[model samples]
Target: MARDEGGATDSPAAAYVFRVTVRIDPEVEGVWTEPDTFETTVVRAADSPGDPGWLYFRDNLWRGECGDEAHMRAVAEDALGMPVDAIDFRELRTTQAYLDDLRAAMADDLVEFNAETVDAALSKYLGSSIHVTDDI
Candidate 1:
């Protein structure tokens, strides 16, 4: 199991957290109003076991407000220099799901890490790819 900073195991039902970074094109006009990167958490529904149902900040820290799909669309559009309609954010996966995929990619070799579990294997595979939110 994955342990938190306090050394307790992370809840299987807890939200998946991600730190998103988008590079802003300097050619855009006017002063830059937003940071280059932001973090958000996706909460999976208990009944829906496969993926998360909503994306929002743990607190109202994202631009002084919590966000949903609509807000993410606007942020991605501005950051990526594209129209909101042209952007797609469907690929964002939950942390557990991501780890499962990684383990699957390993195939039979995953047996070696079975004792430690897929989460440990994923942590080793993704070394530095994992990021934490600064707000919480």
Candidate 2:
């Protein structure tokens, strides 16, 4: 039932689109000449009803060509500036899955608004993985 920063009572979730780039560490020389990168989107409940605010990211996730757990950990640790063990990664939900979750999470809100309208708003970003952070 929360509202977005735009003061729209219908839009209760805030969404973010990120371009994630994973690359091999330059120090490790290998046949792999390119870095792996992907785009991801995350959405979270607005801080307060009618509070319009969102965060942005600059750097991308980078890794080395080794393709080992240690190497992957190094890339995440370096890019995130946090211990590898501390980071938690979760699989994103599909559009249908997200909609189902949203419906469950916002059951009360749905009673106040039309479910179809909410689905339409969220449908535009289908197929993108979502990461729900604690900040939400």
Candidate 3:
């Protein structure tokens, strides 16, 4: 987890909640029994709001965890309207950053009207579709 110049969390430092839908590989029956969900945190420099810590998984493995990163990325990309490479992963506070971003993005005037709409709007403005999820 990278620290900001102020020796604290950065501007985009927030928790982003993502509903990951794991698609089990047909080759491996019940390889993952259920859809394990989790969140990732991202910290960005207050000055450099666009460059935030991103999260990524390789070979379907995590940081010694059960949840998959690819699933999370897919969901996020769908919501954010951007590529997976756009999101940075932070080690110090992944969950916290994710939640913070989620709250900030959703905490808008239209949140009460529809959560999906807010998400879509955020994705469009933020230029990241990785936060969106399918209607599963």
lDDT of 1 at 37: 48
lDDT measured at residue 99 in model 3 versus the true structure, 0 to 100? 39
Off by over 4 Å in 1: 1-92, 95-101, 109-119, 126-136
- Model 3 clash tally, residue pairs: 36
Clashes of 2: 2
Mind giving the per-residue lDDT tens digits that candidate 1 earns over 1-136? 4788999864443233333444444567875646644444333212122234321222112222223546665665665454343222222233555334434644546564443655554444333333322221
Q: How would you encode candidate 2's per-residue C-alpha lDDT over 74-122 as one tens digit per residue?
A: 6555755444432222322224443355545444464433345544323
What are the runs in model 3 whose C-alpha is more than 4 Å off? 2-12, 26-136
- Clash pairs for candidate 1: none
- Using TM-score as the measure, the top candidate is 2
Tens digit per residue, CA lDDT, model 3, 17-44: 3333323233576565343333344322
TM-score ranking from best candidate downward: 2, 1, 3
Worst 10 residues of 2 by lDDT: 55-64
- lDDT for model 2 comes to 0.36
- For all predicted structures, in order, the TM-scores are 0.22, 0.25, 0.21
lDDT of 1 at 116: 61
Residue 17's lDDT in candidate 3: 31
Task: Score each candidate by Cα lDDT.
Answer: 0.39, 0.36, 0.38
